[model samples]
Target: MLLADPNNPTGTAVDLDALEQFAQALSPECLLILDQAYCDFADGERAGRGLGLAQRLPNVVVLRTFSKAYALAGMRIGWCAADPEILASLEAVALPFTLTALAQAAALAALDQEAALFAQVQTTVAQRRRVRQELLAMNFEVPPSEANFLWLPLGAGRLVSPSGARGPGSACAA
Candidate 1:
C-alpha cells in the first residue's frame, strides 16, 4: 500500500505529471490510497488526474469528503472511488447512515454555491500570501504554503503573544 498527500503539510501540490509518475512507480497491483481532503485548495487544472488514475489503476482508491472546500464541515458525508471490490469492502464496514438530514441539505446547498465560495477560497489564498510575506520579513522559517493554515515551530517549545512576550509550548497549541 502507498499513501500520498500531493499537497503535503507544507501545502505543496503534485502536478499531473508528478502524480502520474508516482502511480507508475508503484506496482499496478498495489493499492494507492489518496486522502485528498485539501486537494481543491490546490490551484491548478489537474481535473483528470484522480479520475484518470482510478480508471487506469485498478488498485487505486480515492477518498473525498463533502467537507473542507465545500465548507460543509458539519456533514459526515464522504465519497470514495475505487474498484468494485474495494468499494464493496467500504460498503461492508460503512456505518448505517453517517450523515444526518441537515448535513445532507447543507452539503447540497454548498454545492449549489460552490463557485461563490471558491472566490472566498481565492481570497484566503491571497491572505495566506500576505501573511507569509510578513512572516518571512520577520525572519520566520515559514515554508512556502499552498493551503489554509500556517505551521510555525517554536524550537524552544515557546510562545510569543502580540504584546511581545514569550511563553511555553502549551500556550501555542492551546
Candidate 2:
C-alpha cells in the first residue's frame, strides 16, 4: 500500500502510533510504501519516523523528494529508504541519468544551508496559518494544514466561482 503522510491537498498527518500499528499489521509479503515528500514540513516527531521504520522493516519503503523544502523541483531529484535488497530491486529498473549533476550540487548546497531553508519553511507555515484564519473569517471552511497548501471543502449552497457563478452540490465542480 502507498500513502502520503501529512497528506497532499488536505495536509493531514497520520499519528505515529497509528502508523506503527498499521505497519506492524502488514504481512511481510506486503510492501508498505510511505511517501514523505512533505515530511520536512511536519513537526519533529513525525518527520523522519518513516525512514526509521523503513530501516527496521524489510517490507517498508520510505520515499522523499527534494522538490518542496529544498526548493529543488526543477532539479527533479528524489530519494528512497528501504532494506538494501528492496533498494537493489528498485535500482535494477532505474532510469539512467535521472538525477542531474547540478541537482546534486544544489541539493547538497541546500543541505549545507539547512537553517535558512527551514526558516523559509517556517515562514510558509506561518503564512499558511494566517491565510487559513482569513479564509475562516470569510466563512470558508479550511482544514488545519501541516503541508504548504490548504484544502477547503465547500459546503452545499456555499460554492461560488470568482466570476460569481454558483457551484453545484457540495463542491465547486467547474
How well does model 2 score by local distance difference test? Answer: 0.86
Give all candidate RMSDs, comma-separated.
4.7, 4.5
Per-prediction backbone clash count: 0, 0
What is the lDDT for 134 in model 1?
Answer: 95
- Lowest lDDT sum, 10 consecutive residues, model 2, at 165-174
- TM for every model, in the order presented, reads 0.76, 0.84
Q: Residue 94 CA error for candidate 2 (Å)?
A: 1.1
User: Model 1, range 1-174, lDDT digits (tens) per residue?
Assistant: 545444556665566777768777888678888766666655566422576687777878877776666777767776778989888988899878677889888877877996897897788778888898999899999876545666565576436766565665544653
Please name the candidate that would achieve the greatest TM-score relative to the true structure.
Answer: 2
Candidate 1: misplaced stretches above 4 Å? 2-8, 46-48, 156-174
What overall lDDT goes with each candidate model? 0.71, 0.86
Cα lDDT for residue 151, model 2?
89
- 8-99 per-residue lDDT for model 2 (tens digits): 97898998989988998999989999988988877668877898889788999999999999888999888898999988988999888888
